[model samples]
Target: MTDISTSDVQHLAQLSSLQLDDHEVEALRVDLGNILGYIDQLSELNTEGVEPTYQVTDLQNVWRDDVIDNYDLGRDELLALAPDADSNQIKVPKVL
Candidate 1:
């Protein structure tokens, strides 16, 4: 079993910028000890030949060939539709 002392709790509180009261320090000492004991128990597990899994879901990438579109309107026809047009291009207001 882990033995978390009052001094250890105080030190941790200082490092974390916490101002713990006497009661809070005592309470955390017991709680931290219990947490460490539980973690120590997990160290007894045996997994000698288990494969490491990165992801649990069975997913694959679905890809398709890229295709270029040829709309009926040419550059000149598109520029005519714009509110303002410059030399073979649409004009927009300048932003800072």
Candidate 2:
């Protein structure tokens, strides 16, 4: 079992640029110790003969055939749909 000292907690706070009070530092020391202990426990588990998994499910590329369909429409026909138009051109409000 590893022990987390108050100084270690303070150093961590300094590294993270955190302003920790006395109570907060004490709480952080205990929390960090518990996290380290859990990680140590995980280190003891046997991982021999185990394949490192990259993905859980079968990876498949889902793709569809690209098809292009052109609609036959004149410039005047498109300009008529706009709310505002100027001399055969559609005009909108200035963005900026």
Candidate 3:
């Protein structure tokens, strides 16, 4: 089993900005130790001949050419649709 000290748990809580009580701190100390022990057990597994798996779904991204379709609307025609327009640009009320 991993040895997780009280100070270690307290330090972790401080780093995470957590306000843990004494009971919660103690509980987390044990849990953290158990997690580390499990990781240690996994480190002992034989994976010398195993291949690393990246994507399990075997799916790939289907990409299409980016074609701009303006629907036959010219710049002036689109600007005319806006409530306000000046200097070939749409104008709106100040947001801030």
Model 3 sits at a Cα RMSD from the real structure of 11.4
lDDT of 3 by residue, 1-96 (tens): 699999999999999999999999999999999999888987878999899998889679977689998889899998999999999999999999
Q: What's the true lDDT of residue 87 in model 2?
A: 100
Clashing pairs in 3: none
Off by over 4 Å in 3: 45-96
Candidate numbers sorted by TM-score from highest down: 3, 1, 2
Per-candidate TM-scores read: 0.44, 0.44, 0.45
Q: Specify the highest-lDDT model's number.
A: 3
Identify the runs in model 2 with alpha carbons over 4 angstroms from their true place.
Answer: 45-96
> Residue 88 deviation, candidate 1, in Å?
48
> Ten consecutive residues with minimal summed lDDT in candidate 2?
62-71
Worst 10 residues of 3 by lDDT: 56-65
Displacement of the residue 64 alpha carbon in candidate 3, Å = 15
State the local distance difference test value for candidate 2.
0.88
